[model samples]
Target chain A: MHREDFPMLKKDIIYFDNGATTLKPQCVIDSVVEYMTNHTSNIHRGDYDAAVITNKLYDNVRNIVSSFVNCDSREVIYTSGATQSLNMVVFGYMKKHLKKGDEVLLNKAEHASNILPWIILSKQIGIVIKYVPLDNNYELTLENIKRCVTFKTKVISLAQITNVIGDVRDVYNIGKFCHENNILFNVDGAQSVPHMRVDFKNCYMDFLSFSGHKMCGPTGVGILVGRYELLEDMDPLCYGGGMNSYFEENGDYELKSIPTRFEAGTTPIAQVIGLGEAIKYLMKIGMDNIHEHEMKLKQYLLDKVKDIPNIIVYNTSSNSGIFAFNIDGVFAQDTSIYLNSYNIYVRAGNHCAKELKDEINIKNTVRVSMYFYNNYNDVDRLVDALRNSKDIFKIVL
Target chain B: MDNDLRREIIMDNYNDPMNKGLIDDNSYLKTRTSSESCIDDLSFMMKIENNIIEDIRFDGEACAISTSATSIMIRILIGKTVDEAKKILNNYKNMIEEKDYDKNLLGELAVYDSISKQPNRKNCALLPNRAINNMLEELNKKNN
Candidate 1:
């Protein structure tokens, strides 16, 4: 665990809310601060020293992202976050290509960012939205997806790893299936890319969306990597000076190509530069090593919590480090409050996966999502706190 | 903070809440409310006869504070007139906001007197009050 890299770890608290966002590493913060302090200038416009430095640092992130996610640099589109990226995919591309009555396959475990835009699209056009059911383990396997697919299934969009269940979907197999069937594949990498190696080319993904903040970078910057051909077909959700080549008074204009066209406005320049540094940081640490560490930590937490009888643990078999649980008779918020009293931070609620109740039969849960920075001490602290949750009301009251 | 009194009242009311179920009566007015941030979803029903709060009931899943507070609230409002209930609500809101209020009027409701300190739980403490206040507004509109 690279705990020392994150200044937040020095605080007397155990943060297990990585599903929401991870704590930023010092290098990422320093990079952003350095840009704001020393070399602050608008990108791709000026030839001054500050502007040159800014443009180089900002533009170079495309290569960094391409290498990080294994996609062409020309295909990388800077966005506000995964939410905006997803919106661009659904409204910008899918709206035009997918006609009325065409079906899109989704699952209940998907976060709202992945589901809501499609729902809006279904309402606007007449596209049919179908949900593939999760198996007994609350997982979406390729078999389940296959059962839900029809000839009209034009698209299959899913999170590579679900935020709540933390179960990894076989997107590679699903992508291959889509490729053969000529169906479009959109991967919500918000919960996947940061923790593991995601090869966009190998997976045959047409679209991939991920936020920088989730991977220990700054907020307000995200990456959307689309297949080059599809990116050429996609439209920018925004329009401004940065993305245009030339314009005429009669509204006749030429926009830039592929990725540049999609990133229309003045982008979050500092955050993007910081995100590049964060990607390099994660690369140095090794995605496989980060993933392996998380799995081990998840297993350790599962084993340690076994002795606590009244604790109702959910998704014990999830491949990722997200652990959802509740003290049998206690409310999730009460547990969260009780834990907060002890400096243990966990997320408590629907977690924006509102439709997940159909699968889990519960509306709310206390989620403890981890990053590689987490260690055994954090789990021990959590178990110790949970073991005394009987005295929860004592602290909460 | 009245820790002892608050703890005792909360435990008793939460374990076995008063008026914790809805009636099948057609005359009563009901409304359901849920918190967007937390899991405090509760439904409230009130029967007002001749400007008096004849009876009230609530049913659903909520945190201990929400359940216990609603339990205490329904118990207090059962036999009170509509005007009296409004006064109680006003005073309760005042207390929740950490403003000057008559605490004797709150009785068991004062258990959440210090809830303002736990700013995050203020909504949890007031979720029931919000729903009941809606019922009050509807009743007031009908009466006018």
Candidate 2:
């Protein structure tokens, strides 16, 4: 819909790898460039013109994030990306609170970022990592989660929308369930936050993690929003100059409060500024519009390929814009290569969900993940390339 | 190299691979290699007697580049001594890395000359070659 907002549209490419990272809008890019070119100074320390500008931009991002996610600004913490955010949740918070044998419910559809931290935590503490089985459509239903829930299930951690399957998990209902059951709810919003409106307060989430790059912001920035009380208990995974309030030679140091304490040292000021711009850009166009456009695109692509005998789609019933498919005998990478020949970029292979192989029964699939910027022409090009995939080998070599 | 010729080389080697299965023999040293990113998990088995690679076989799910490259690699390394195979694999590595490699030495492996352009696929083309190369290096170490 807002295709013109993205500068990459000027290029001769059809980018369908938004599941990995979205194309940055001109406004987002300009924000970063402007920050670097003009106000190239460290945030929060200086009272000078540049520092004031940078600090205002950086600090105000918390409000932007809070407004976007419907969280308190005090609850927002900045990290490298979703991976780091999830790590802080597991190591910083869960490791301290979760006792041995406490079960954390997860699914195979989650990206490694969400799963690996808990797996590592399981190794550290005697936490039991349990996989809530996916349904026949490979969707994680609340019913399956309910069945897996035991008294020992201390946490229910999941992606709001899976990367490969693109199933929009009912985080609202699941969050309510967790709230009622007195379980900690951690939502990996890496796939969800970019596409839809996620009400962190209303969802009753204890923690939420998401990246900036996947939402048209620059890399090296992400938001980690924890509940206010939980933020007080959570220790910083990283510690240095900015986060500390006082230090003495007697091996004693006092750290800052809630969110700032978690954000140790110099944060990605430019990236944070870029992220704020990205969020503002997104809100202007509206989240509901983005989601609706993606669903429409998904259905359009599905209906077009349903008749093609050799084309096998994995997630026809999935709720998002992701399309996982392959030509009958072609390898996922091979299909991706063929599509690249037509200047259409898509992700291929395990897609960082290595455990998904056991559930889907196939090791790899070419994934075409759409964003709001993608239009009908992009899909038509992909379809045309798929139709002419007999020459895949010819081009791939 | 013509694009059609390259396609034929890859497709031919992929469709009908050489010694495409591992034997349950005690003498054959085998190793399974796969990327956590891609789906290719090939078990490469080798039998070496007095420094010569008597047999080499591989079996797994892989893309055309990986399968075809592995097949062609097996054909090239079989019956060659450990040292010779090392030299050939070094040349193949050189070629894959876009370093100065002997043009005539590669023969059929020359089809992947353009693989460096698609750097992402370089791992796929080099997977089995690297495994077999490591085996040869180990054999060289033990024998020397």
**TM, chain A, every candidate:** 0.99, 0.99
- In model 2 chain A, where is the ten-residue run with the lowest total lDDT? A388-397
Write one digit per residue (lDDT tens) for candidate 1, span A1-397: 8888889889999999999999999999999999999999988888899999999999899999999999999989899999999999999999989999999999999999999999999999999999999999899999999999899999999999999889988989999999999999999999999999999999999999999999998999998898988877877778887889999999999998777887777889999999999999999999999999999999999999999889888798889988998899888888898999889999888888989999999888999999999999999999999888877888888
TM for every model, in the order presented, reads 0.95, 0.95
List clashing residue pairs in candidate 1: none
Candidate 2 lDDT tens digits, A164-257: 9999999899999999999999999999999998999999999999999999999999999999999889888888878989999998989988
TM-score of chain A of 1: 0.99
Model 1 lDDT vs. the true structure? 0.91
**Candidate 2: Cα lDDT at A74:** 92
Q: Model 1, residue A299: what's the lDDT?
A: 98
